[model samples]
Target: MDKAIIVFSRKGLFQKTLSAFDIRSREHARKLWPLVSFDESRQMVTWVSPSFENGRLRRRAHFRVLPTQTSYNPKQHFDNQENHRWNTVKESTEHRLAKELITAEISRRLNYGLGMPWRFKDKDVSNFPFLGNLLLGADRVVRLCCTKI
Candidate 1:
């Protein structure tokens, strides 16, 4: 299986979006995280996984925004109104793309597991300090791990 680590800055869009969901519980927060990348030049947001293949580390793009789609720009209006409208459109577009990437990644993970049930084993929880709550109550762990994704 491939391994990946994604670190989102406190002020970044992903982090802010997660915060907006008001994930007060540790279990819920833990299950909502996804691995993704954004390419500025291509204006693409992609679901990616890093793996060791043939003795080399390779990054694979599982899902990505197409070039043609990324070129989207809001229609021009008056000077000030146009800039404001453009910013709004851009932010919304980015948010939508991020959500799509996360959804694709979650679906990929589920399919990759071949329909086996998700198990938050003790050992796995121990390795991740944020998941310590699982030790307190295994029953509290969210079964539908993709709820936020």
Candidate 2:
């Protein structure tokens, strides 16, 4: 069957949201990890990976903040095989028409529930407006260069 990695998330500053929850502990997937359509019409990422053209790789990549709890996908965000699928799904998500996206795109998840204008603190980055934790309509996405990268 063809695959279409349709990430289940709301629209935001990001051109696209993650398609499926990251595979965490093989029991639960981290929320918002891009979904795998598994349909040939779309895309699929196997435990292993397939190669692509170099130019294709460079063109599809766009920078955005990531979550710190990478334990969800302990496989490493840049895992050779998985990273390709991750990026493909992400690019497709962002380019699709906004009418198709969901409310959660610009909102946040909270202990009480999920909603908008969230105040999330990334201990990873000691600053306000952290990535994923955005002050939408506020103009800038908050990002802290705390990662040694």
Candidate 3:
């Protein structure tokens, strides 16, 4: 099975309409990422996964974006599509750590509560360090930061 790792989320002013996934080999120094964008004429979303050679990464015309059959609805957005995509992807023990890392980070941002019914597999997934109260406090800080900007 091919392994992929999400190095980090690349969000900024320049790439406003795209989300990138940086994948790298944990055993080697190789790096790769998928840059997702919308193709208006094709009416389909594009996923461009790049391969690197000569240990250098660059924007070149040799790469191609493959079109998947999946069509995203603008009204509903990615909430439903993400759930379906997650279920369709083949799960393996190799990527368990990467999955847990992303899950924990999202759970942290959402402030997962013990009372919530959401579960990972058959068990309820709860956030450690109990940040519910902290999130409330952080909301004030976030507002202050936003207002300053």
Q: Any idea how many clashes model 3 has? A: 0
Residue 14 shift from truth in candidate 1, angstroms: 42
- What tens-digit string does per-residue lDDT give for candidate 3 at 1-149? 12222222355312434233422232222232322233432233323345568877664222233356353344465567766776766466656666667556646675643222332342356443332343343321121111111
Across residues 81-117, which tens digit of lDDT does each residue of candidate 1 receive? Answer: 7667666555456666787786666556555542323
After best superposition, candidate 3 residue 7: deviation in angstroms?
21
Question: What is the Å distance of residue 82 in model 1 from its true position?
Answer: 24
Q: What 10-residue stretch in candidate 2 is worst by lDDT?
A: 140-149
User: All candidates' lDDT scores?
Assistant: 0.40, 0.36, 0.38
Candidate 1 lDDT score at position 131: 25
Who wins the lDDT comparison?
1
Whole-model lDDT, model 1: 0.40
All candidates in order of lDDT, best leading:
1, 3, 2
